[model samples]
Target: MSVADIKKHLYKAIEEIDDEAFLQAVYTIISSKMGPGATYELSADQLQILEDRREKYLKGEGKSYTWDEVKDRIRKKDGL
Candidate 1:
């Protein structure tokens, strides 16, 4: 279906929703989507690890592989 059709169906469904708690939850979800993109809450240690790996990659110290090489290795291991 088209976007307009989906919106019409959503509006009708929303109107029929009468539970206050459910409505509040749905409102919170829709509002979150309408605002800036969703965010991730990462721990300090996890963030540090990611930053360290990125730095190594930028410095050309990280191991890399081509797509074909990766597929060949997977195929070999799987005996495909």
Candidate 2:
């Protein structure tokens, strides 16, 4: 079957799940299969840009938002 077919079946299976313990186990299995977070090596230019942004933030030249505020704004913007 195609990836789309597999995804549709997976979605249906997820929706039909009723046992909380089984569902949690399924989540753990999927998380393990997906492995760890991604890693990237930044180039010198990218690193410099990030450093500049950090310096600006330290100097209070840019605004910072709390995680909750950011998530709320994102959810509202996306109509989630």
Candidate 3:
């Protein structure tokens, strides 16, 4: 599917999910886009990290975080 198609389907799916799942899915996508940087645009270090992570992921050596982990991290950073 095209990127647009995938995004559309993702949006549709999230709209039907419970609040927690939706937040988690959104966080996962946003985090992946963030990589090792503060901006959506990748920095050199972030680009290298992404490339290495992709390679590790393809080889089943990558890691992942749960939705709760991300939510809590953000909350703490913002003093929520």
Candidate 4:
């Protein structure tokens, strides 16, 4: 879809949402992208770490979990 169409749909969807926390999270994300300081620069070490992880994952040597799995692990750890 076009950017304009996507934005129009987002506006309508956001208007229908009644959850304050969900709206706040959306607002936070939007503001971070829209505001100054939105452009992030990774330090040399941080970039190297990310590159290393990507290489490992591409080689099938890095373990990964789905969002549901991570949530389940967190809940189990917290006894929630």
Candidate 5:
């Protein structure tokens, strides 16, 4: 199905919904993710962790892996 078709179907389904609470929940989730003014605020601890990681990366102390290597690790961990 195309993106346009899925959006039309969703619109029609949402139009048929009568429960205000369920609609509000759906609206909250969609607005939080895609609304015009939507922005995520990270906590101080999260910011500090990111800064530490950046410092390590700049100092060549952080390890990095290729996408295929990461996928292989995940597959091995999952016994796939």
Candidate 6:
């Protein structure tokens, strides 16, 4: 039902597994973006840095571009 519940279920299931195929299946689930959410809390300094990044980004001073323009520029710069 909840993420924690799913995680407990997953761990229990994984602990019972012996097959390579089963392990791969669990690996696929774990690596998926929609699967488990990362469990971490930032330090105060890290949070401040993330907030500073947001402030900088909102100022349009990060890297201005449309998708293709940015891609092409990067390609040219790298002589790709």
lDDT of 6 by residue, 36-57 (tens): 5563568999999888888888
- The alpha-carbon deviation from the true structure for residue 35 of candidate 5, after best TM-score superposition, in angstroms, is 8.8
Model 6 Cα shift for residue 65 (angstroms): 35
Give TM-scores for every candidate, taking all chains together and pairing residue i with residue i. Answer: 0.48, 0.50, 0.34, 0.52, 0.52, 0.35
lDDT of each: 0.90, 0.90, 0.86, 0.94, 0.92, 0.83
**For model 3, how does the per-residue alpha-carbon lDDT over 1-80 read when each residue is reduced to its tens digit?**
99999989988987887899768878888888876765457689999989999999889889777999999999999999
Top candidate when judged by lDDT against the true structure: 4
**Model 2 per-residue lDDT tens digits across residues 1-80:** 99999999999999998999999998788877775753346899999999999999999997899999999999999998
Report residue 4 deviation for candidate 4 (angstroms).
Answer: 6.7
lDDT of 4 by residue, 1-80 (tens): 99999999999999999999999999889978787867567999999999999999999999999999999999999999
lDDT of 3: 0.86
Q: Which prediction has more favorable lDDT, 5 or 6?
A: 5
List residue ranges in candidate 5 displaced over 4 A. Answer: 1-30, 33-38
lDDT of 2 at 62: 74
Model 2: lowest-lDDT 10 consecutive positions: 32-41
TM-score of 4: 0.52
Alpha-carbon runs more than 4 Å astray in model 1: 4-41
What is the lDDT, from 0 to 100, of the residue 12 in candidate 6? 94
Per residue, candidate 5 scores C-alpha lDDT tens digits across 10-61 of 8999999999999999888888879665756789999999999999999999
Which pairs clash in model 6? none
The Cα error of candidate 6 at residue 42, in Å, is: 25
